[model samples]
Target: MRSLEIHGVDDLRVVERAQPEPGPGEVQIAVEWGGICGSDLAYWRHGVSGTATMRHPFVLGHEVSGRVSALGPGVDGFAVGLPVTVHPARTSGPLPERLAGRDNLHPDLTYLGSAARDPHTDGGFAERITVRAEQVVPLPDGLDTRRAVLAEPLGVAIHAVHRAGDVTGAHVLVSGCGPVGLLTILAVRAAGAARVSAVDLSPLARERALALGADVALDAAEQLGQDVTVAFEASGAPASLEAILRVVARAAVVVQAGNLPPAPVSVALGPIVSKEIDYRGTYRFVSEIEEAVELLARSELAEGVISHELDLADAGAAFTTAATDPHSSKVVLRLE
Candidate 1:
């Protein structure tokens, strides 16, 4: 089998490797498609994501979908040839948070393909890989693998919506039109928002957001002109977060959904204190992966989102396109 590995900054390669076998309560997946995430780009361009630097070569993907090829001992309710998407998170130790059903808050959570830990765990950018059976979420009938591959990101969007808290009939602002931001718009709509407005510097992104049901799409420089009841900051830019904070109505909920830099960022405290706004942060999801897949399976959620697809052998070029192409949304590598 072949795998895509990141060795260092600006260094990526396709190398031959032995096919992995499933361990107890695990499953072997013949990966079909994997999406390159922003974190993956960070690792490729700077050899780091957030504060986590690459300690060694590791596989570079987490948003993926594939078919079951083999099942390990004691695994049931799944069989070979079934299509599935992975949850991508694993945690150990019985912490208070884990025991409370907030496993994502566990101190020792390991996200696949992440360089956050020493001896980084391998990801699913390979011809064959093994994962704990529990991490595998089976796809619903009629959902194709191509669309199922987006479940990971959609899970993130769903989690952000959950963080925003009861957006029903409220005017919502999404401060980015990237893949996650646009998907957040869709998720907000599905969560019953009255209206959604998207902001982005990229015209292509804005156009796509409008096509995906954003009531209005505006350039980042333009003022929103109206007070939103809820806002989601998905641009990962301090400036964007500031913009949202300035425009939202009093008592509005602001959910920080994007990954911000590790450094301190300046923000005015007057609005937060005066308005008594409910500002919150959302991490990766728990139990939202299934909801994401169900949403995608029922709608044209994948349309206009997947801008490019490449063969696994062209993984380097794929990463370059994803990093440099602002017009592009999701760049997926086909491994089958």
Candidate 2:
């Protein structure tokens, strides 16, 4: 089997590795496609994502879809050759919250392809990999693996909209038109927002945002004159947070959907205090992965979302395109 590993900043290599076998309650998947996420780009460019610095060489993919090649003992309700997408998170130990279906809240949760753990957990940027059967969700019939690979980041957008509560008939603003941001636009529109608008520094991203159903797309530099009832900050930049506060109506809801830096960020406090904006933070989803798959199954959301598809052997170039290409949305690596 071939694997893509990140040794350090700007150090990515494709190496051969022993094929993994499924363990009890696990399944081995022949990886079909995998999307390169922003976090993956961060790790490739700087050997870190937020504060999670790499402690060892790490695999660099989480948004993945594949077909089951083999199944281990004790796994049921799944068959070999079944197409599926995976939930990348796993709990380190049994926790009350995790057992109660709030696994994302578990303090010791490990997300694949992340360096948050000392010995980083390997990810799905490979020819084949094994994962717990419980983490795999079967793709709906006729759902292409290319679009199914988006379930991971689409789940993030779904979870953010879930945090926003009722968006029906409300004006919504999505600040930042990255993959997650563009998907957030689709999610918000599907949630029945009356008007959906987006902001991004990249014109290409803005254009894609509009194509994804945003009523209007604006550059981050432009002044936002209309006040929105709900705002989503999908860009981790501090400036995006500040901009949302300025454009949100009084008593509006603001969901911080992006992963911010570990350092404290200073922003104006008057609006939050006087306007009484409901500010919330959302983490990885619990059950929204299913919703993401369902949503993608119904719409053309995946049309422009995938910008490039490269072979697994070109993992380095794939990461470079994802990191530096302003027009690229989701860069997928085909393994099979």
**TM per model?**
0.97, 0.96
Write one digit per residue (lDDT tens) for candidate 2, span 45-94: 87778878998997878899989999999998998889999999887677
147-235 in candidate 1: lDDT tens per residue? 88899999999999998889999999999888899889989999999989999988899999998889999986346765698999998
In model 2, the clashing pairs are none
**Which 10 consecutive residues of model 1 have the lowest summed lDDT?**
218-227
* Cα shift from native, residue 26, model 2 (Å): 0.5
Total clashes in model 2, counting residue pairs 3 or more apart in sequence or in different chains: 0
* Candidate 1 lDDT (Cα, 0 to 1): 0.90
Per-candidate clash tally: 0, 0
